[model samples]
Structures are given as C-alpha cells and as structure tokens.
Target: MADPKGFMTTPRQEWPRRPVEERVRDWHEVYVPGALLPIVSKQADRCMDCGIPFCHHACPLGNLIPEWNDLVSREDWRAASDRLHATNNFPEFTGRLCPAPCEAGCVLAINQPAVTIKNVECAIADRAWEEGFTSPRPPERLSGRTVAVIGSGPTGLAAAQQLTRAGHTVAVYERDDRLGGLMRYGIPAFKMEKHHLERRLEQMRAEGTKFRPSTAVGQDIGAAELRSRYDAVVVATGATAWRELPVPGRELAGVHQAMEYLPQANRVCEGDLEVSPLSAAGKHVVIVGGGDTGADCLGTAVREGAASVTQLDIYAQPGTERDEDAEPWPTYPKLYRLSAAHEEARDLGTAPAADADARLFAASTLRFGGDAEGRVRRLHLVEVDAGRRPVPGSERTLPADLVLLALGFSGPDRSDGLVDQLGLELEPRGTLARDAGFATNVPGVFAAGDAARGQSLIVWAIAEGRAVAAAVDRYLTGRSRLPAPISPYDRPMTV
Candidate 1:
C-alpha cells in the first residue's frame, strides 16, 4: 500500500467544480482544468486494496480499480492509464458521464467516504492524453474478416475498436448525421464537449476502424443485405423511444419529450440550427421527471434564458445519505444527488436553488391548460400520496409555457423500421432479445447496448459493446481471442 494509514490521515477530497456563475454562462464542462491532479494521488492512496475488491464487481466494465489506484498513488500515471484502459475503451467518457457505482462498493465506504476513484480515473485519463500516453493501437495483422457494427454509441464504438485491434476490418454505421450516437447529439455539450468525442473518433480511424456516418442499415442498406455483406453483424442501436406521460392534454402545444427538447439544444451547439425549434427562452418551463434526463432539461432551460424553471418528481426526495437498512454497504445506495444541472438550477434560483430554484417533490401532473391559440400556458398538478395518487382537494394550477416530459425512455424506437425489417424478437420489456452471447435468433446477427438491455449507463453500454464484439468475433472466426467483459445474461448488481 502506498500509505498504511492514508484512509484515516487524508480525508476524501473530490474534484472541485467550476464556480456556478462562471460555468453556467457557457457550454464548457464544469470542472476547473488540471485542478484534480494534485489531490487525486492522495485520494488514490485511500484505496484499501481490499481482500476481495468489490469495486471491480461494481463496475460494468470490471475496471481494475484497485490496481490503478495503487499505481496512481505511487505517481505512476502511465501504468495507471494502461491498467485503466485495459478494461474500459474510454475512461474519459465514463469518468465524466457515469454515476460511479464502483465507489458504492468501495471497502472504505463501509465506514467512511470512498476513495475518489472516479476522480482519480478522470485524472489518470486526462494526464494520459496530456502526456501523449494515449495513442492508436493498430492491429499487428489483418484477420481478413469484415464486421459491420450498427450504431456509433459507446457500445458500438468500443466493439469496433476492440474488433479492429483483433485484426478484423470493422465498419461502424451510425444513423445520425454525425457519429458518437447519444454522446454527440442527445447529451448537452455543457456536460461534455463534442471535441473529446471527435478526438477519440480520429484515434479509432487511425487504428483502422472505418466509420460510416449518416448511413443507417435498414434505411440506406437492407438489414438482410448488411448481414449477407459482412461475416458478422453487431447491432448496438440504443433505446431511443421516450417514455410518455399519457395524461389529458397530451396533444397540447409546448408539451415535449425531454429527448425532443434536448437534441435541439445539442444541435444548436453543433451550429446545425440557428435557433432551437423548442427553446425555453423567456418561458416558464416545467420539467416532469426527476431523473438525470429531467435535470438535463433544467440545465438547458436555464442556459436558454427561461423565465422560470420548476422540476417535479412523483417520488419523495431521496435521503442525502445512504439508508443502511434498506441499502447495505458494498451496494450502490439510493441517495439524493445534486448533478451539474441541479447545481446550475440552484445557482439560477430554481427549486434546487438555495434562494430561487423551484422543485416540487411528491407531485403529479393532472392536465394542461392552453390559451385561445392552442398554446399551453398552464399545468394542472396535485400533491400526491405515497402511492403517487393525487390527494383530494390538492389540485393547483402552475404557469408553464413549456412543459418537458423528462420521463425516461421505455425502449428502442420500433418505428425506425429496422426491427421490423430484421424480424427481431423483443423481450417482454420491449427490448431486443439476445441469447447468452448477445446473438439474436439470426445466426450472423447480434444485438447489444440500450437497444437490447434498455436504458442504462454509458459504462454498461460500452461493456456490452466489447462483450458483443467478442461474441461476433467468435462466430466469424470459429473461436475468438477478444475479451468479453460480461455475458448477455449477466446482470450487474447496480442494474
């Protein structure tokens, strides 16, 4: 161990976010550049390197956390990066986007705060890039097998890279005009700039992974044709269908799904649109759903100069700390978190706002009220009981010029014609059904990521991609040497 008493002597210190006022004014990431490096070593020293190291099990990628922690604590960033990258294809993406369940399983977290594993990871990745430790690892030989990977999201991208290194000629097909799937379009640049994604894509291209953006398999090329053209086909299309609020006034103008609103803002950032079609500027915005997607809407509304913002959650607010009885140690705790968006909302005097932000807990929407122009102007809501049923005589009207249904996605968009064309079987949950090896009923076709697993973390998506790639490799070559992080049937503890 780097320091025997490090956990006790050095208290946990996390990376400091940029000042709220300064960060919210622009689309840059919230962190102060290079600010976490000095403290990361100390935090890394706090890792107990437990006898069992449950952190590994906690991560979907099964990242070698303790090993990298020891390396970082000893100031061996190169080795730390190597260990970090051994499992995860993109630590930079996960370090920024993933809600670190690994920390929950930290041995130190049984009593004290967990080591800042995520922060250390981000530090190691950033340092690697700065020091030129990260580079393209082109395969030594070509396998002469061609593989078609559908979707350019984390999973597909990871699989393509892994397969490319396995000497397979991999072609990543993205439906979107640009690559990176949700990373490039769904997520706001404020959380993560597109440049990070572009750089990685450049690296992948250099490593012999070919990208075919704006080319959807079912649309541009027939699914059967794609399967026939390639030795193996891996479908990594993510869940794109937004869950709807089917209450009365659903047809009212100004009521939009969070995805509908979020992507426009992201497109505006890409300079594709002069102005977003559904901007919240000068309007009172009500975000329904209290998950990360809802928080994202809240942040976007704030930046777009919304007159007011209110976020509502049907469920009661989570406890600030872990519930020991309900959620034991070594398991991810259900706790309240102030995300970057929530923090921004608070800074803007919204409900999470210390002085102004508006959040309504245990609230349920009743209906929408529109003006003569058929434009929504108000929302009918009520305080709900623990069952989420409205309490009698608790109905009230709140001004809501724009209402975003931040309720999460249900499954992949079946309307895309891809599923129908492929005649893919779906599970009861409406996700594509895959067997133990992430293969669909069709011999040469396989599915992975959110499309197959439903809405999940980026880390899991990438893991699925890498694992599915191994399955595809095995099918193509009769036996594979690629590492499979997890099986299609393997459900993580966090999930």
Candidate 2:
C-alpha cells in the first residue's frame, strides 16, 4: 500500500472546474489548467489497494488501478504511465470522457466517497506527455500482412495502433473529412479540447499507421476490393444511427436531432465555418432526452446564449444516495448526479424550469405546437408514474423555439452500404453479428466496438478494439502474442 492509513485519513478531492462565467465564454475544457498535479498525489494515496480490487474487475479495459494508484502516490510518473498504458491504449481520452465505473466499484465508496481515481488518471496522463515519457513504438520488422479498419473512432484507433505495433501494415478509413470520429465532431470542445486529439493522431502517424480520411469503404471503394487488398479487415464503425422521436410536429423547421445540431456547432469551433447555421442564440431550447448527450446539448445551448433551456427525462428522479436493496455496493447506481452542464444551467438561470437543475423528471413529450411557418413554438408534456403511465392532471406546455431530440443511437449506420456490400448479419439488437472470438461469419473479416456491441462507453470501445486486434492477429499468424482485455461476450455490470 502507498500509505497504511491513507484511506482513513485522506479525503477525496477532485480536480476543480473553472468558474462558470469564465468557461462558458469560450470552448476550452472546464477544468482549471495546471490545478490537478498539485493535489493528485494526495488523492491517489487514498487508494486502499485492496487484495480483491473490485475497481480492476469493474473496468472494461481491466486497467491496473491499484498498481497505478500506488505508483502515482509514490510520485513515480514514468512507471505509472507505463502501467497505465499496459492495458489501456488511450488513458487521455478515457480519463476525460469515461464515466469511470471503476470508481463506483472502489471499496472506499461503500462507506465514503471513492478515491479520486479519474483525476489521478488525468494527472498522470498529462504529466506523461509533459515529461516526455510517451513515444511511438513502431514494429522492428513487418509481418508482410496488411489490415484495414473501417472507422476512425476510439475503437478503430486502438485496434490500428495494436496491429501496427505487431508488425502489420494497418490502414484506417474514415468518411469524415478529419479523423477521430465522434471525438472530432460529436463531442464538444468545452468537454475536451481538440489539441489532445491532434497530438495523439500525430503520434500514431509517427508509428507508421496509415490514415485515409474522407474515404468511405462501401461508397468510395468497394468492400470486396478492400478485402482483396488487405489480408484482414476489422469493422469498428460506431453506432451513429440516431433514434427519432415520433410525435406530432416532428417535421417542424426548428426541430432537429442532437447529432445534427452538435456536429454543426463543432464545425464552427473547427473554423470550418464562422457561425453554425443552427445556432441556438436567442431561442428557447428544449431537449427531449436526459442522458449525457442531453447534458451536452444543454451546455452547448447555454454557451450559445439560448434564451431558456430545459431537459426532459422519461424516468423519475433518482435518490441522492444509492438504494442498497435495489443496487448493492460495487455496482454502478442510478443516483441523481449534477453534471457540469446542469451546474451552469442552474447557476445562470437559463433553464427557467421549476426544477433547480433545469430537468423535468418523469416528463413525457406529448406533442409539439408549431407556428404558421411550421417552426416549433411550444412543447406539450405530461408527468408519468413508475410504469410510464400518464399521471392525472399533470399536463403542461412550455415555450420552445428550438427542440433537440437527444435520444441515443440504435446501431451502425448503413447509408454507405457497408453492411449490404459485405453481407454481414446483424443481431436482434441491431448490432453486427459476431462470434465469441470477434469474427464475423465471413472469413478474414471481424467486427468490434459499437459495431458489434451496442452503443457503450469509451472504455468498452477501447477494450473491444484490443480484443478484436488480438483475434485478427491470431487469424493472420498460426500463433501470436497480444493481450485481449475482455472477451467479446463479456459485458459491463448493470443495475
């Protein structure tokens, strides 16, 4: 253990966020710069480094949580980074974007706040870059084999990096003009800056990984042609076919999907455009889903100077504390949590909703009322019970000039005809069908990440990528040595 009594004595202290007023003005990340390193070591010391270490079991990547926590506590930055990289291909991305289910599995969380594992991880990753600890590890000799990855998201990137280091010529194809997939456009800059992604792409290029942006496999190049060129093919295309809300006035001019709205805002930040055509300025915005994407929309709208913002949740509000009978310890619970976006909305009075956090739990959208020009002008809703049945005498309407449906995605988009060209089978849940070994029915073709699994966290995507790379490497060579973090059938703990 780093410290014998550290868990008992040290209280968890997370990285501090910048003042709402200062951060909302620009697109920089919310955390205060250079503030984590000073306090992270102490926070890391709180790890009990338990014999069983449920945190490790909880993480999809099987990250060496206790080991790295001890290393960070000892101030051995190099060793910590090395240990962190052993299982995870990109700690920087996960440290920022992952929900950190591992923390929920922390032993300390049974009684007290969990150790600041996420903050410690971010600090170590940032320090690794600053101290010149990270570098490209190109293969010493080529295997004379080539592989093609179909997406440029985290899953595709991780698989490509692994295959390249194993001496295979790997090429990643992305339909977007730039790489990084959702991290490039779906995610906003206020959550994570683009420079972090750019530097990592630079490192991947240094390692001899080839990238083909703006090249859609089924559209630009035939899938059969791609299969003939490469020895093996891995599909890591993410689930981006967004779900739509089928309600009255759905075709109104001001109603949009969250994906459509977010990407345009991100383009403006990328300097592709001076202003987003769908800017939320001077509009009363209503978001229909209450997941992380909805919170993202809330934050983006707040920054864009929306006149008012409100989020609707189909489920009732959860309790502040975990319910032991329903969700025991070491399992992620559905507790009421205040995200940074909700905090900004609450403080700025931008939501105008009765709820302090700008969210209406148990709220269901009935329909939208539009103006003569067919622009959405108001939203009609009703409160619901546990069974989702409407409660009596609880109907209301709110002004809404702009309505964003933040409902999540269903499965991988097939507009480019990738699935049809390859004749890939899909599961009942709308994901690409794959065997336990991450192999598709077609020989020499594999599927992983959200394409095989459903929409999931970034940590799970990286794990799936690593696992699929191992499967692909084994297929190419009679015998191989590559770490597979999780089995294709392995799933996360859910309540």
Candidate 3:
C-alpha cells in the first residue's frame, strides 16, 4: 500500500456539480467538466485497502478498487487505467451511472464518509481517454467463429467487444436507428453526454466489432434464421417491458409510462425530434414511483420547464444516515441519497421546502381524473400507513396535467418475438431463464444482462456481458481463456 496512513490524512471529497440554475438551462451533465481530476488522487488516498475489501464483494463487476486507489495515490495513472480496464469493459458508463455499491461497502463508510471511489474511477477513465491510452485492441489471430449479439446496451457491447478481442467475428445488432441501445435513447444527455458513448463506439468499431443498427432479430430478420446463420448467438436485450400503474382511469391520454416519456426526450437530444411528443413543458407533472427512473423524469421535466413536479412513493421515508441497528456494516445500506436530479429539484423549490425533497413518502395514487377530452387533468392520492393501507381521511387531489408511471420495468419486451421465436424459457419473475453458464435452454443460445437478470444497474449489465462472453467462448471452443466475473444467477445486495 502506497502511503499506508493516507486514509487518515485525506478527507473524502467529491466533484462539485455546476450550479443548478446554470446547468438546468442546458442539456449537459451537472458536474463541472474536468472537476474530478484535481482531487481524485487525494480522494484515492482515502482508501484503507482493508484486508477483506468488502467493496470487491459489493461491486457486481468485482473491480479492483483498492489496487486502483493505491495506484492513483502513487501517481501511476497508466497502471490505474490498466487495472480499471482489466475487469470492466466500460468504466466510463458505470462511473457515471452506477449507484456505487462499492462505496457503500467501504470500511470508512462504517463510520466516517467513504472513499470517493466512483469519482476516482471516472477520473481514471477520463484520463485514459484524454491520454490516448485506450485504443483498438484487435486480436492477432482470427478464431474463425462468427457470433451474433442482440442489443447494443452495456451488456451486448461488452460481450461484443470481448468476443471481438478474442478473435471472434462479432456482430452487434441493435433495434434502434443508432447503436448503444438504452445508453443512446433511454438515458438523458444531462446524466451522460453522447460523446462518451460515441468515443467508445469508435474504439469498438476499430477493434473489429461490427455493428448492425436499425435492425432486430425475430422481426427484421427471423430468429430461426439468425440462429442458423451465426455459429452462436448472445441475447443481451435488456428488460424494457415497463411496469404499469394499474389504477382507476389508467387509460387517460396524458398518463404515460416513464419509458415512453424518457425515450422521446433522449431522441430530441439526438436531434431526431424538435421536441418530445409528450413534453412536460407548462405541465404540473405527478411522477408515480420514487426510484431512479422517477428522479430521471423529474430532471427531464425541470429542463422542459414544467410548472410543478411531485413524485410519490409507497414506502416510508428512509433515514438520511445509515441505521446501523437495521443495516450493519459490510452490507449496502439504503441511506437516503440526493441525486443530481433531486438536488436540482430542491434548488428549484419544487421539492418540499421542509427537506427539499420532492418525494412524498407513504403516498399512494388512488386514481386519476381526466378532462372531457380523455386527457388526464388531475391525480387522486391517499396517505398510506407502513402496511401500504390507505390512511383514514387522507384522500386528496393534485393538479396534474401529465402523469408518469416511473414504476420501473418488469422484463424484456417480447413484442419483437425474440423469446417466442427462439423458444427461450423465462423465469417466474418474467426474465429469461439461464443455466449456470449463462446459456439458455436451447443449445448455441445464451442470455445475459437484463434479459436474463431482469432490470438491474449498468454495473451488473457489464458484468453479465463479460461473463456471458466467457461462457460463449467456452461453448464455441473445446477450451477457453476468458475470465468469467460471476455466475449466471449471482446477484449483488440490493441497496
């Protein structure tokens, strides 16, 4: 360990976000560009490099956090970048998007603040990009095996890159007009700009990974035909079948799913649309479900100049600090976090003035009130007890020009017939079922990411992608040398 006592000397610090007023006016990430570079080494010093290193266990990717931390502390950025890329195929995406379970499991988090691992991670990834350390690593020998990977999301991209680097001719098929799948359309530009994705796509293309966009299997091309054409197939299609809010007046025209609303805004960011079809501008929006997706909707609405925004949650408000009695150390604790979106909402005075939180805890939507034109106009809600039962005399109505169901996704969309055409088995939870090796029931067919694991974080998706690639490699050849990060059914602790 470089500077063994560095953890005691350096206090945990993070990148300062741009002021809400200035950032909300534009569709750029909230952080000041190049903000983390200056403090990342100091923050990296805070890693204690604990003997057990619970961060490793917590991370779905099993990233070498302490090693990278020490390397950064010693000013070995090249080594740090190498270590970062050793396990993760796309640290840039995870650094910006992951909830940072590794920080939650940090030893320092047991008492004081955790090490700024995520910021350091993002800094390392950015440094690598700036220094041209990341380049096309096309394999020397061709394995002569052709693989078709469905979806261009994190999982599919990681798998395609790994397979390509392993000398397999890998073609990534994306249904969208552009690649990156949800990374291109599901995520907003404010959370992550598109250039980062484009840079990685360029690197992948240069590395012999072929991309086929504006096409989908089982629809554009028959699933049976794709399976027959490629020696092997990896289905990395993500869980996108959004969960519905089954309440009264659910069919109102103005009431839409979060996915329906989010993707439209993302498309506008891509210059595909002048404006989102369901723009939240001048609307009093009520988001149902207080999750990350709901927060995303809240941010998007703020940028669209929504008159007012309120998000409701069925669960009671969690504590700001960790409750050690309920959630002991070494496990990811569900302490309340102020995401960039929530911070923006608080600054705009849209959140409750008391705590500057837009979330109304223990709240349940009873029904919707639509105008004569069948467009939603207002929302009916009730205060709920711990058991989620409606509290007496708590019914109220709020002005809502638009209602967004940010209730999260159930599983992958099957309307494209990917599952039915391939005769893939599904788990009880509606996700594709897979074996220990990440292989589906049908031979030569494999599944990973949200398709097999259900809706999960980007970190998990990348890990699933890497593991599935290894599994497919072993299947294609009598023996393989690829590293498998996790088992098919291995899941991280939910925070």
Candidate 4:
C-alpha cells in the first residue's frame, strides 16, 4: 500500500471545475486545467486497498483500481499509466464520461467519502498523453484474417484496436463523415474537447486500424458485400433510436428530440454552421428527462445563451447520500449528485425561479401549446405524486420557445437497414441478439456494445468491445490470447 493510514487522514478531493461565470462564455471543458495535479495524490492515497476491492466488482471493465491508486499515491504516474492501460483501452474517455460506479463501490465509501477514483484515472491518462507513454503498437505479423467492424463509437474503436494488435486486418465502417461516432458529434466540447478524441483516433490509425468514414454498411454498401469481403464481422453500431415524447404539440416546429437539438449545436461547434438551426439562444428551453443526456442539454442550452432553462423529471429528487436500507454498500447507488453542467446552470440562475436548481422533480407533462406560427410557445405541466399520478390543483404553465426531449435512446437505429440487410434478429428490447460468445445468429457475424447490450456507459461499450474482440479472435484462429473483460451476460453492478 502507498500509505497504510492514508485513508484515515485524507479527505476526498475531486477535480475542480472552472467558475460558472467564466465557463458559460465559452465551449472549453468545465474543469480548470492542471487543478488536479496537487490534490490527486492525496485522493488516491485514500484508497484503502481493500482485500477484496469491491470497486473491481462494480466496474464493467474490472480495472485494477487498487494497484493504480497505490501507484498514484506514490507519484509513480508512469507505472500508474501502464497499470491502467493493461485493462482499459480508453481511460481518457471513461475518466470524463463515466459516472464512476467504482467510486460508489469503494470500501472507503461504506463509511467516509470514497476515493476520487475518476479524478485519479483522468490524471493518469492525461499524464500518459503528455509524457508520450502512449504509442502505436502495431502487430509484428499478420494473422491473414480480416474483420469489418460497423460503427466508430467507443466499442467499435476498442474492438478494432484490439483486433489490429492481434494481427488481423480490420476496417471500421461509419456512416458519419468523421470518426468517433457520438464521441465525435453527440458529445459537446465543454464536456470533453474534440481534440482528445482526434488525438486518440490518430494513435489508432497509426496502429494500422483502417477507418472508412461516410460508409453506411446497409445503405452505401450492401451487407452481403461487406460480409463477403471480411472473415468475421462485428457490429458495434450504438443505440441511436431515441425515445420520444408523444403529447400535444408533438408536431410543433420548436419541439425537438435531444438528439436533434444537441447535434445541431455540436455541428456549429465543428464549424459546419455559424449557428445551430435550432439554437437555444434568446429562447426559453424546457428539457424533459433528468439523466445525463438531459444534463448535457441543460449545459448546451445555457452555453447557447438561453433566456432560461428548466429540467423536469418524473422521479423525485434523489438523496444526497446513499441509503443503506434501500441500497446497501458495494452496490452502485443512485444518489443526488451535482454535475459540472448543473453547477454552471445553477450559477447563472437560469433555473426556474421557485425551484432554483432548475430541476422540477415528480413532474408530469400534460400537453403543449403552440403559437400562431406553430412554433412551441409554452409547456403545460403538473406536479405528480409518488404513483406518477397528477396532484390535484397543482397544474402550471411555463413559457417555453424550445422544448427538448432528452429522454434516453431505445435501441440501435435500424432506419439505415443494417439489421434487415444482414438478416440479424433483434431481441424484444430492439437490440441485436448475441450468444455468450458475442456472435449473432448468422455465421461469422457478431455484435457488441450498445448494439448488443442496449444503451449504456462508454466504459461498458469499451469493455464489451474488448470482450467481443477476444470472442472473434478465437472464432477465427480456434484459440486466442486476448483478454475478455466480461462475459455477454455479465451486466454492470448497477440495477
């Protein structure tokens, strides 16, 4: 252990964000750069290095958390990076995007605040990139087999990198003009700058992972032709079928899916447009949903200079601390947490006047009202009870020029005809069905990530990608040395 009594003395410290007033003016990441360097070690030292390390059980990747925590406490960043990369293919992405269930599972959290595991992980990854510890590791010899991975999200990228290092010729097929899928356009720059995604793509390309952008597997290129050219196929196309809000004013011009609104802002950020077509600027925005996507919308809307922003959730506000009775230690608990976006929005006072935090929990949407031009002008909502029934005489109306549905996705998008063209059977949940080996019903075809597992965290996507690569490697060579992070049926520790 780095320090036997470290956990007893040090308090949990996390990476600090840039001040709200400053961050709201630009699209840069929320964190104050270089702020974590001094405190990260103390935070890492808080890891008790539990004998069993419940953090491992909580993480889908099964990362060696304690070992890396010890390394960080010792200020051995180089070794920490090495230890981190041993399991995770993209710690940089996970460090920023993941909710860090590992921290929730920390044995220290049973009593005191948990170690700042996510912050430490991010520090190690950033250090590795700066110190040149990360380099292209191309295979010394080719296995003579070829693989075609559909999609360019975290899962596809991870699988492609693993298969490439295993000596197979791999090509990633993406429908978008650029690589990285959601990492490219779905995520905003303020959360994670696009440069980070670009730099990693460069490394993957240098390592012999061929990328084919602007090619839709079932549309631009037929699935039959794709399968014929590749020895094995891995579909990592993420779940893009967004959930809908079907109520009055559904056909209104300003009522949009979160996917529709966020991507437009991202495109403007990418220089595709001077301003988003659905820019939230000078408008009152109401976001429906309280998950990460809704928070992302909240942040994006604020940055766009919206007049006001309000987020509505069906569930009541979560507790600040984990309730051991409802959710005991070791299981990832659902607790009230303030994200970087929420902090900024709160500071701006764009939240509803009465509900200053901008969140209206236990709320129900009755319908919507539109102006003469059919543009969304207001939202009709009511307070809800524990049973989700409307409370009596608690109805209210809010002026809203824009209504964004940040409701989560349903399953992988099939509009492009990839599943139909490939004749792949989908589970009842609308995701592609796969066997324990990550193989689909068709021979020489497999699936992974959100495509197979439904919508999930980026960490899970990368983990499943790594696991599916091993299954594919063995299928081709009859045996493989690649690591399988988790079995197909192994869900995350979260309920």
Q: Tell me, by lDDT, which candidate is best.
A: 2
| Cα distance off (Å), candidate 1, residue 79 | 0.4
* Model 1 per-residue lDDT tens digits across residues 1-495: 899889989999989989988887887888988789989999998998889999998898999998999999999989999999999999999988889989998989988999898899889988998889888999999999999999999999999999999999999999889999889878888878888898899999999999899987788888888888898888888998888888888888999998889989999999999889999999989999988888888888888889889998888777778888878877788787788888778766754322224568788999999989888998888989989888999887888899999888777787657888888999998999989989898888899999999999988999998899888888888899888989877776743
Name the lDDT value of residue 357 in candidate 4: 85
| TM-score of every prediction relative to native | 0.97, 0.99, 0.98, 0.98
What are the RMSDs of all candidates, in order?
Answer: 1.7, 0.9, 1.3, 1.0
Instruction: Record all residue pairs in model 3 with backbone atoms less than 3 Å apart, i.e. clashing.
Output: none
Cα lDDT tens digits for candidate 4, 59-142 = 989899999999998999899999999999999999999999898899999989988899999999999999999988999999
Across 44-109, the per-residue lDDT of candidate 3 in tens digits comes to 988998898999988988899999999998889899999999999998898899889899899888
Residue-level lDDT tens digits of model 2 in 234-352: 99999999999999989999999999999999999999998889999999999999999999999999999999999999999999998998998888888999888999999998877
Reference-based lDDT, residue 358, model 1: 54
Enumerate clash totals for all models, in the order shown.
Answer: 9, 0, 0, 0
Instruction: Give the local distance difference test score of model 4.
Output: 0.91
RMSD (Cα, Å) of candidate 2? 0.9
Pairs of colliding residues, candidate 4: none
- Kindly indicate the candidate among 1 and 3 with the higher lDDT: 3
Model 3 misplaced stretches (Cα beyond 4 Å)? 351-355
Question: Which of the two, 1 or 4, has more TM-score?
Answer: 4
